[model samples]
Target chain A: MKVTESDDVISFAGGLPNPISFPIEALKASANHAITENGSRLFQYSSTQGYAPLREYIAAKYQRVHGLDIHADDVFITTGSQQALELLGKVLIDKGDGIVIEEPGYLGAIQAFTLSEPTFYGVTLENDGLNLEELEHALQQPNVKFVYTVPNFQNPTGLTYSKEKRQQICEIMAKYDDVALIEDDPYGELRFQGEPLPYIGAGKLENSILLGSFSKTVTPGMRLGFIITKNKELMQHIETAKQATDLHTNIFSQYVIYDYLANNDYMEHVQKIIALYKNQADAMLNAMEEFFPAHVDYTRPEGGMFIWATMNNGASAVDVFHKAMDQNVAFVPGDPFYTSKTGVNTMRLNYTNATPEVIREGIKRLGSIL
Target chain B: MKVTESDDVISFAGGLPNPISFPIEALKASANHAITENGSRLFQYSSTQGYAPLREYIAAKYQRVHGLDIHADDVFITTGSQQALELLGKVLIDKGDGIVIEEPGYLGAIQAFTLSEPTFYGVTLENDGLNLEELEHALQQPNVKFVYTVPNFQNPTGLTYSKEKRQQICEIMAKYDDVALIEDDPYGELRFQGEPLPYIGAGKLENSILLGSFSKTVTPGMRLGFIITKNKELMQHIETAKQATDLHTNIFSQYVIYDYLANNDYMEHVQKIIALYKNQADAMLNAMEEFFPAHVDYTRPEGGMFIWATMNNGASAVDVFHKAMDQNVAFVPGDPFYTSKTGVNTMRLNYTNATPEVIREGIKRLGSIL
Candidate 1:
């Protein structure tokens, strides 16, 4: 058995954001401010409802940026968007309930919902987003509780739903009264191309719950995220579920982020990160175009860290992953991302952490191995 | 219909440690050092396995302080002791599986386990600890997956098990090979009286999992805790569960606590808190004895925040609570702590937050209402 190399290898297996993107100097100032201004409250066990000021900021952001009229009461701060998914799974998913997911969606979502032993229904992904027809068919099945979608630049696929598809999906969701929709948009702010589309939850859709994160746009290590919903019944259930989880997200992290947002230009900071990742993505895609086999196809992502690639001629992604690792480049085999047992010849390559030069070099090495 | 006040009352309701006890200066320094020295790593997504240095420190403390031969591999850092309980509930309990809990235990544990829909068997509590006869009877029930206990200074009751009871409980657990034990000891280090006893997990009890927390001793708002178990299978399952729940505990908080532990005198700091709480507890107890009716009875705890008080003649604690709140004093009624539907004529008071003078005044006001 071959032992895996340490950090010496250039790898795309990690879903980490660029370290340079973190506002460390600003955070230090915020930390000092928090200590000086509200040290006692920062250390205290805060309400399970989360910090009021932070919630207000988040609520205002949704309204001003996305044009969604969310009140502070509708927002629940979580340890991460991951925790929001878990809480939803706990509250909404009865044992053996069916949950729809994109064919190659996030493994974290799958893991979060799997604890409830929910039957997963996979909707095939097109260039735009989830296949609407497949999703409608899945919702027709008995016990289908909710549809989990990353409408923005998705985790592994890095695919965003087109405006037409987003509207159609929302329309289809409106027709189904029983099934709720979980719109997990962690990477929404990372878009590097075209105008931002309205969120699936932007319209007066009571059944849709939106999950947004500071992880991608701000700092992943802070573990701050939130859920927005208009359905009072569902929000109450999720809030209870959140209480049972970690009581609430860390008060200090929430306060620091609140302070940071209050003082800095969040959009500008996110744009800086988007610029960094865009350069890396361009380098990787250009290298892939130059060196990859003619039969291979990959998504031209608009934004986010990952680029989904599919090899031709029935080549296993796991096999490709092993070969790529040997070449000092690593990517997560896309099989785990799919709910179905049948493996696809696909993998996810993350470009955020790598420099432009490293991305080019790593992709070239991987191409040679392929 | 009368409108109830928002649940945001000055809660003696939560089992929170004194906010004053948090070493804000040390934490600020640690946070500064973590960001300044290791900003990139601190801000980056960390291993799901947890921060290595923090795990090593916790493991070392277990060995040095308790003479327990536990390795770092045996420890898993969690978002909080709350998440540890949540993970255990997810991995261990199946629907309809029986779990043994104290008659009046931590509400957080109850809420965490409720998601699994396990049939809870409540064991009666004794002055020292859990009633052994009741515990044995509960353990005899078929499909009892585990017995959850807080052996050292329990949450609501502030009771610690005697050395003999600990040995007997371990022997019984050994006798029943199928049954597992979850010993949550968040308040073990806060002992103000008697010498510290070995944890039940220390006696080569492979069937037990011990949970330790930095919350009560250091800072609850940091939300740092760990689970130690000898069972590798259970630990692995929990790690998977944790990955789904929140990916991992916040990396920055983990690093901050690790750095603080490395550079600061944690023991001395905790001792100061213990001394402060002991004085507060003494003041509260003295006030209660002087002011309360002769028929009212309460426990005099050696450590931890709570004092479980029972009213005579089935008097409603909720009524007393309302009256006390009207007099500007508040406490959590004990009924919600029980797994059973039957309400107990009792309430729990926390002495940790209030100063000696405040505690005495609060108790006097509460006594006047009763």
Candidate 2:
């Protein structure tokens, strides 16, 4: 009873995939298969590092997808990528320690790291990538823990960094020996138009910690994700942190996901997601271009669930949010995404959940209200 | 790859339910039913408070089982009771904070809170319950965050507090306005022969935080657990901490558990488990009575998975543990369970994981070694 609680509300605030994209048939089959074949083990306690085959598969996928050499030992399966952030916060952040994040960042990351009592420095984001100058300055801050970024089709904003910026950011992070770099890429496989850019992890930055999730391409219900890094010391700390947190992620989930991945062409399945989200994203963008107020500008995202819209002349998104709720149309207000007193006039509109017609209707209502 | 990693290793180290006790058939049916009927919602992201019906059910169960008046709003579903400990640590413990624990306490709880850098004060536990004077002294310590205890057939020791002791402990904790009380009852429902003692929360301790788990009754694979509290402020902090941790537990697991609970007589199933474990525990106790050396004292537990065994005259359990492992019989060493330098001659043996024949052979071997 959270984001999907109301049926009357045309909600575009969710950061997950449409339920129709869920591989229900395959999952059902996998459930039966796992229960029949590995019920005793699947339904029992598992290691903190996760199911061996699944971890190996994830490691292999990284090699294939990002051209990054990673071992199974370097990966630990989490309940979700959010848990990874929380574990990283536990392992890395100290009270009053500085943590670098993107301005208008993922709110979940903000919530996760804040629990550890870290001081945050949010680097401004250009259309193409992060502001390198601000990132450098933030990295140079005393006791800076890590630079957190969603480098591929970032949440809320749905912006992917250029290849040049990706490499440059990696270099900038590498120059700072103390700070680790978290390259969160939940939407990496959702790209529609451009060639897939190299992950910052591919730059071979030893401190580059890459996080990936199946929430967008697969089902969020499973809540499966992974944290991969070459740093064994950091990984060991994270593993201990994870064990301290949940013992381990649900073993049944790891088994089900593994069964599904092994029995199906996961890449082909992700391709279908890319196609569907590409259409939905295009529809939302097209409607926004046609119906949005002249002063309101939004990103033209190639992939991911959301479009970041900023209303010029200081029009508050929270005000619009309240008004839109009355109209039975909802979008997430952007203030929570900002660590500072910024993004007051910005909002995140998710395009992945609603159809083209619904997107158009919602945009029309908002335009008239504005 | 934890306790059950090797088939050759007859490990009594695990604190989970036997896999054979898992309702695999019912779970498979529930899985299929959930996928077919509620896949869209089940697989989608849900609330941090948990699935509404499940929370209501948990609150109802507490009323039925422990005679506690609780609301659905007072319950937050955790990944396992382990995550509850982790969240508690994050909310309550800070670097150098004082926390009271039982001597030879739950190792998992120690691991969870140690991440928060708390200075632990372990009070010695007697047969019936904790030594009240020591507990009172520990509670009076400056900066004490909370007192953590598993009062119902506790892990490793398998010691359940008497109802009067539970009440007194609650009153003692209530007097300490600076600290809270965590009553972890993962094995409360497993009592086959003992009288149903009132929970510490039933004493109306204002600061009491109760944790319960479904892992033992249903299956550990799902990793479903809950944190119940009447204190809304503390509950809010735990919810925020949980949201930062894993967003929420696996949704499908919640749906399946809910479905199973609603459709079946969950109590009857648990009763079946009670019978099975009671037999196993009795067999192990009988074997120990017949085969154990005179100086090797052990608790005659009426319930729970473990029996507290202490070898007299300073016999090192660490040495016994290594020898036991060499003989292909494994148990958790007692050192990790203690917060202080004590319990040197102690070890814990689990009865839930072995059959009567196996228990007999294992005890015979251990007796010969002693």
Pairs with backbone N, CA or C atoms under 3 Å apart (clashes), candidate 2: none
What does DockQ come to for candidate 2?
0.83
Clashes of each: 0, 0
Fraction of reference contacts reproduced per prediction?
0.82, 0.91
List candidate 1 stretches off by more than 4 Å.
A1-5, B1-14
Supply candidate 2's per-residue lDDT for B74: 88
What's the TM-score of each model vs. the native?
A: 0.96, 0.96
Write down the TM-score for model 2: 0.96
Question: Candidate 1 lDDT, tens digit per residue, A136-238?
Answer: 8999998999999998778888888898888888889888877888889888888888889987645556688899899987788889989888888988888
Q: Please give, for residues A1-370, the per-residue lDDT of candidate 2 as tens digits.
A: 1543388887788776877788889988888897798868988878888999999999988787667788888788999999989889989998899999998899999999998889999998888889999988888788998989998778778788898998898788778867888989888788888888887744477787989887877788888999988888998999888888899989998898889999998889888888888888888888888888789888988777789988896778889888888888888888888898753988888988888888888888877776
Quote the lDDT for B48 in model 1.
Answer: 76
CAPRI accuracy category, model 1: high
Docking class of 2: high
